[model samples]
Target: MIGFSDTSISKIAKRASVSAATIYIYHENNEDLLYKTYLKIKGKMSEKMFQGVDHTRTVYERFEAIIRNYVDFIQSFKDYFLFLEQIMNSPLPQKWC
Candidate 1:
């Protein structure tokens, strides 16, 4: 994959089958796009990580359920998980988190 340093708005827009102006219609700039994507993926991961977690269950059971759900998310959406990992190490998190 092309690293973010080498990526440009036009390149991303072309890859996404949209024009650069189209991207700007929703994002202020490249960093905004990346930050928004990070938020979206993080929301998805959070949802999956707590899905079907029963509050009525014992503490241990609840913890185990959360862990299982997280494992399932990582296994089923490996790309999203990896993206999150990459973003966590980037400056975007410091700027937005």
Candidate 2:
């Protein structure tokens, strides 16, 4: 899901040992799956970003720690970062604004 367009529903289903129809039960289409996956990844990233920084620190300090965490995550997960970067560069619907 992170790699986005390079993969097809059949590929994902086969990789997960499920049928394509089973995937449809959870997502209407590839874009929907991508959106859901993005949310999941973002949540995990945020959790990691806030893992060890002291809450008593200043807002700026905490934000800097988050930036460091974000950079580390991108470096560690280049493919996931690239997929999100591509999606962000893509044209979005007016409703998204």
Candidate 3:
């Protein structure tokens, strides 16, 4: 979850009912954690957004499908979409990630 940047991994582990070391095994730091989470969310968003969209449709229909699916995806995963927007607009996130 892309919570505040100051959130501690230890706290995250506690909330998740996992050991701090377990979190470390998957992420070296909060940036890494956020990066991985963002990637996963983005993948899911794309997958759900494109599902059943027919490429054979005309340009206008295809554009409509894209817009409709994007709206549906954002509504279904509001938090993830917001996180992505925040990351893209802010300087806190490192591009190297």
Candidate 4:
């Protein structure tokens, strides 16, 4: 697998068995694609982090539950978790805020 820095739209298209033009139809550019992918994964992670956590519970309890959920998410989606970490540490994260 190519690292994020080495990946290109054509590579992604080829892997997905689609044409480069098809990828362009959905993403304006690679940066846009990465941004969207980051958002998608973050959304899923957030969902996991909040799953079954009672809002009415004490702050400590909620925090603990969220941490547990985060651990579960990391274990279940290690690749996604690593992707998120990589993106978060990159300059692209500035665009997110």
Best by lDDT: 4
* Residue-by-residue lDDT tens digits, candidate 4, 1-97: 4567898999999999999999999899999999999999999999999999999999999999999999999999999999999888888888667
Report lDDT (CA) for all predictions. 0.89, 0.79, 0.83, 0.93
lDDT of 3 by residue, 28-92 (tens): 99878978887888898888778878999998888788789899989988988998887777665
State every prediction's TM-score relative to the real structure. Answer: 0.93, 0.73, 0.85, 0.91
Off by over 4 Å in 4: 95-97
Among all windows of 10 consecutive residues in model 2, the one with the lowest summed lDDT is 88-97
Best by TM-score: 1
Better of 1 and 3 by TM-score: 1
lDDT of 1 at 61: 99
Model 3 score (lDDT): 0.83
**Collision count of model 4:** 0
Clash pairs, candidate 4, are: none
Runs in model 2 with CA error above 4 Å? 1-7, 15-17, 92-97
Which of candidates 2 and 4 is the stronger one according to TM-score? Answer: 4
Tens-digit per-residue lDDT, 1-97, candidate 1: 7666678899999999999999999999888888888889989999998999999999999999999999999999999998888888777677775
Q: What is the lDDT of residue 58 in candidate 4?
A: 100
